[model samples]
Target: MALSEQGRHALRHPPRWHWLLLLLILPIVAVSLLFEGWTTHEVDGARTRRACTSPIPRSADNGAPVLRVTGAGAETVQMPLRTAALTFDGGPDPVWTPRILDLLRARHAHATFFLYGTQAARHPDLVRRIHDEGHEIGSYTYTGGDLGSASAVRSQLELSLTQTALAGAASVNTRLLRLPHTTTADTMCGGEWSAARRASDDGYLLVAATARSRKPPLGVVRQYSHSALGYQEATKLLDDPEVGRFTTVTSGLGRPSLTAPASLLQRLQGNALIWTQSLGHRFARSMTWALGIAGGLGILRLVLLACLARVHVRRQRRHRSGAPWLREVNDPVTVLVPAHNEEAGVEATLRSLLASTHRDLQIIVIDDGSTDRTAEIARGVGDPRVTVVQQPNSGKPGALGTGLSYARCDIIVMIDADTVFEPDALHRLIQPLADPTIGAVSGNTKVGNRSRLLGRWQHLEYVLGFNLDRRMFEVLECMPTVPGAIGAFRRDALTAIGGISDDTLAEDTDLTMALWRVGRRVVYEERAVAWTEVPSTFSQLWRQRYRWCYGTLQSMWKHRHAVFEVGPAGRFGRRGLTYLALFQIVLPLFAPVVDVFALYGVCFGDTGQAVGVWLAFLAVQLVTAAYALRLDHERLRDLWALPLQLFVYRQLLYLVVIQSVVTALLGTRLKWHRMHRSGTANQHLLREPAPQPSGLASK
Candidate 1:
């Protein structure tokens, strides 16, 4: 059925909201990365912190911790009374800050707290408590980073963001600034003094701790953290008989409070910032869990494939070891070639089949309304065994059905018009069918046009991702796909399912599952090699994969009831279908999130860990791919581009799976999309004698 104009337009240019949603994903991910970075102290952290580099100037009275700077000069400020100003540095910590506040409450002390923006943002209630208890607020330079070591922009952001965090948490902004990793006014040397001067220009009164020796008798300004040691020090000082009343810096200096109530607009902006940070935190946390699960599942699948492949190989060796397991099948067979505008490769396909080592053959070419000379090219092969059937513009299943009507032989082999089979491929593909219980045999499908990087990637995927999994599937007796490029079926079993039906875009998958439903064993034949052309460009690959994925989903849903049925159907349903659902459908959905989090880890989090995991994952894949390649008798050099494939090729496949899932869920009908054949499937054959038909078998 033809889609409506709206549907066509919608498919071509999806609704604005769809694009808007896509656009939102990046910004949302970026914000989430930023939030996680800030929470983890990556934005302004101890890793980038430094200590005071030079001594205090002589013009500034050195012993005093607080510096009072005017437009003309700078001087130290001290309490007129025999008073000590108690200031806490670093946290508004969740546990320590609360405990310290309790001690201050008990003593009726109003001190100063220089807050880390991260801690304040994380524990806003503590920030509010400090302000409400009459304790003065001061900036602790965001993540307690040293201002002298940081760039000018870093210094400003640290100060402003801290002010905003305070405004959001307590509705107040402070003018008192304390550079982290710097202590005692005398220690403010070189770059530290310059940074202090810069803060003074912004109306910030720079505060440091007084020298420990002089401060004990002179009632010095003390610096502490919201920590156990800081609490113990504070308690002892509170009980000191020599020290006068414990109070805030401003109060002891006989000056007004440095903190002022934030403007309404400032408060709103600050609150928004706070809310965004919290939301990002939640998003990051969720993605982290999702990424871990996805990563684990991915690794688990590779391990399963590797282990099961070994079992599959051993089983094969055992089978052939005794007496050629299922005796060599020399039965007459009918080969069905479905084509639509496949002129470029129809001749090569027909020639390859005609030259089959299994001599007795009947080849039927069903040309479904080709604008090009596909039937002509096929007929040009000039073999009595070849028969070309032309039909109106119908899909692949239709073409297959038309060809099936002409299949006089009991064994039916279907090969796409774009595939070139090795001489022994057909003979080997059918040997498994000799076992009466086996209904279908999946041949090894290799990418032939692998001279280019894109082709190499596809070749790797064919050997590693698809073929390796098939080995495992065969071992588990749950094989899901028999490639359209080369698959064999018993005529009785093929006919039992009412021949081919256009039930799904992936007729091969649908047909294979149908065979399994009727208690037919589908097995893989790695020795049965056929070379087919995979899409060479990203767009071409996308269309081909999109159709395949969508059709697979439809077939899975169609055969969903098989899960409850007993025997072969139940095994395939439970194992093959479940695996497809979990690994293919569900896991790929989380890929974008996983990919973003991976980038976050590399850029803003632990880069070594991130890169190490990625390299490890790639290394495992490479090892498995090498094993698979050796099993298929291919060279190992193809793995040189495997790393690049992970970064580029994998993302494209992820997107394809995502879009296909979305299209399936939307109930969109995916019309059969035929790829343009470039006759590249016979690339290996070209390396053979020009007169003889051969594929990779010649090599």
Candidate 2:
């Protein structure tokens, strides 16, 4: 099958896996949320407080019972005078570990190195090098999470995974372990004591740091990190004469040690842990990169929208000021209204067209197999200029093609069945056709049924998102879609593109792109305004947007070859298609992940940073939306719905894009979705008189 056919098939019968993929994401998010919440409650909060203020409890003689657990679960161990043990915790760092190792090598000192499984797995060579260099290896746990606060499973996994990494890296496992966040043997208290006892039961020896003093203490196991600062601190101890001998904990204790070879099963488990940890690390890195890309693209789009909107405003002002120099096209025109089960708004649409300021018009309403009285309503208008044509069901594109066939004028204006036009809308819509280079013109479309929150949210989107985007597209000379709600095209342009194609669901977009490919300019005429009723509920809105998004994908794919063409087609293909793919399709797909990351930050990471970034992005949107509303002569109060819209309405739109892309990829075909209209378009227009064009004469 051809690529287009494949796309159609994907839309019609989307593979089950497509939905499964989306469903899978939900469980992942839920798991992440649960994990993050648990971590925050059990570890993160306490950890933060401990970092700010010492968490280790003090005991008499500066020996904390809860800080350390030896083989016998002893709070403190008595060592021979003039002997000191050096221990390093928290890493097998690629950079710092090597430097520390070099320092230790220069001093000919061997210390116990407590390795985090995650870091050890990531830098297994370092782990092996530490062991090979005659240093004692011990477990610092998998993620260096505090075993004191960890669940039983987490504590076991932490220690076992570290052992697994050790066994995989060096084919040997050690009994020595270290409790994370504990400073000295005397510092272990409450939960730390309990955790130490548990490790002792598992046949692991626990090591902790001795208290720091002006004079180095002999026979004390001093812990340090594998970092530059730790190396500096350890240098002081190595240089101290009081610390007579620097050796491993077991050596200092006069215990003979032997490297035990790992069992095959142990090695296998270790390697598996290493693989899983590595995969998690890679996934985290990928998400970080994705977040950056998504954020950058989103910001770039906003900046472009704002800048291009200013350019559009300036250009429009220049045109308005020099209106006398503008050529007025007063040629006879044909208006096509393709209706399908649109009995609710067809009469109002016909009445609005009859009220156009331009005198000459041939209005044709093509009823495409409507089960309602849409045709009857159009014919009942009883106007000479209005003609109703009945046709069998063939979809919007086919009905539009039929209307185009009966068009008698050089210019054809197309409006949706649910749209109500202003008195001067038709006149302003056609004025752009006076330019021979301009093949088609897109008009300003506004949401009519905006009383409810959903409608109000969509209203803001129309003025802020769609209309502002059209202005930018016009300034760039890469207008991708002349909206079906209100657009005008030269009849020659329509004929050149073979009337209207039913190949793609979005006929208007497809035709607009075709016009651009043929080297004809498509411009936006903001003065030509039409009010159209939007979906009233979430479900209805979702279906409408799904069809729109899918249709747009089909159109873009159909014009894929234009990217390699010369001149205008290449420009439109590269600039227009690239913009659409990035800002529309790609960003929306990644937005859910961004939201998930933000939620994670709030739960387990830095809540302030996450909220700050989100607020900054929202601020940029608010400014842009405000400017867009200003340009469209809409009230700023509508922006109150925008923030709330971001939470729910925005997500719904993203889901629509996701579903559409999935459908397109799976080669499922989708039937056209028709909204159930309530004639809200007429109600809105009747609520207030339509604004007339300034300094323009009505025919």
Best prediction by lDDT:
1
TM-score of each: 0.92, 0.88
Give the per-residue Cα lDDT of candidate 1 at 75: 74
Look at candidate 1 and give me any clashing residue pairs: 54-189
Reference-based lDDT, residue 629, model 2: 76
Tell me the tens digit of each residue's lDDT in model 2 across 336-393.
9999999999998888888888979999999999999999888999999998999898
Candidate 1: tens digits of C-alpha lDDT, residues 562-663: 888889999999999999999888887767778888888888877888899888988888888888877777789888989998788888888778777666
For all candidates in order, the CA lDDT equals: 0.82, 0.79
Work out how many backbone clashes candidate 2 has: 20
Tell me how candidate 2 scores on lDDT. 0.79
Candidate 1 positional error at 60, Å: 2.0
